[model samples]
Target: MSNTTGAERLRKRAQATALAVILSVAATSSLPSTNEGSKDMQNTGTTSPNASENLTDRQQAIVPIAAFAATGDIANLNTSLDHGLDAGITVTEAKEILVQVYAYAGFPRSLNALAELMKVLDMRKQRGIQDAAGRLPGSPIPTGDALLAAGTANQTRLSGGPVKGALLEFAPAIDVYLKTHLFGDIFERDNLDWQSRELATVSMLSALSGVDSQLQAHMRISMNVGLTANQLRQLGQVLADRVDGNVARRAQEALDRQLAIAPGP
Candidate 1:
């Protein structure tokens, strides 16, 4: 065996300890109990009082689009976008999901998916299909400090509290961006409810590789926001049927991990 320095072993142990603490905090704090989330779920308008019922047509339409977009399957994304429009998913709602996609999938994929959407819409118009140009958020978006404050609040609620972890502490800017931009600006926008947004997020994360921790976190967030475990399982089936089996497997693994940690209703 090669000699390993005492300092190197200590450093490795410290890193492992930090990761465990972060994962513990994330799992415990990011998800509210079902009873705790009920009121918020009702207010969001994304689900019925019984969230376990089958997802609505619009919700189903969004699942594959989100998965394909996150995985950079442009051709499949294009087909799903057209199907989404045909299934009564308004342009505004679809646009909101794509914008949210950028937060997880990054700017390049998000931008490309959006561009694909525009092309889909233009082609549909040529084919004489009039996809609904959905309404924008009626309220004005907050600016400057107010925007930051609103985002912080939104982030707290979604995460079940103010998020704190080793990685966030290492790069506080990322936490700020998550709160101010991802949770605050994008989440504040109307048309899509928090539940649907979380659903899209969870679906996207499930398709992406090597982000099991984030995927697991989103699974909790999905539940906290209103999706039932049964609904998420159905989403896995949707991914298998509509997208890739591997993506579905990834989603199932994340969900399983979440369930093992926190058995929910």
Candidate 2:
């Protein structure tokens, strides 16, 4: 057979396989229905999944960060990069992932996670590994009302609600911050926009052990960013097929959540 035909057949098979796996995972899991439900569930654990089964190159490349973010597993996060870096991932890209998740995950995880990334950097330098410690391509910083206005728009669009003057289940202050800080401050950074950032967040959270609700919410938000149902299904399948065992469950949970909330076609 011709190489092009082989490649075409492979792509179709991959998509089909991904769909089947995603459907299976979606069958048994569930996600919370309200913003209050999300607030009540702030699980922060980390897990490692085996990516040896049948992951593509793109999925494999992103598995580490997603797994680490999902479970907040510092040790595995470190180990994941050890593999990625050795396999030729640049330090800069790794840093960007960690830094970006701070808005979605939180300061504590983000701080600890970034610290871990820095540790990897220090080790890389000592061993002369030559991974990048370079800065982002465009270090754009948001400022003033321009920042606030954009954040407001981003938050409203992402949550499918007003997102302003909303009260938090735990801390009332955080509701404002979500609209202002997460959507406004950190999100306005140009290096990564709302869509790509949310994609990474959904993927990472889905691979986590306990953040199923958050994963589901982001999966919804992910759709708001123009991500199709099939695209999300592929993401879940990619994580399940390629990432660790725990992530398969997480990905499945996320898929179930999406299926529940997805408007009927």
TM-score of each: 0.80, 0.61
At residue 96, candidate 2 shows an lDDT of 58
In model 1, the runs with Cα more than 4 Å from the true position are 1-52, 263-265
Model 1 residue pairs with clashes: none
Candidate 2 C-alpha lDDT tens digits along 115-160: 8878887887898777745334343445677666756665544555
lDDT for every model?
Answer: 0.70, 0.53
Best by TM-score: 1
Relative to the true structure, candidate 1 has a C-alpha RMSD (angstroms) of 8.3
**Candidate 1, 1-265: lDDT as tens digits:** 2346655754553444334323422121111112344334423423343434777777788899998888789999999999989887888878888877776678889899999999999999999998888766645667788878866676656555555666888877766676666655665665566666766877887787877777777776676666888888988998999998998999999889877766334
Residue 219 Cα positional deviation in candidate 2, in Å, after optimal superposition: 0.7
Error of 1 at 108 (Å): 1.6
Model 2: per-residue Cα lDDT at residue 180: 55
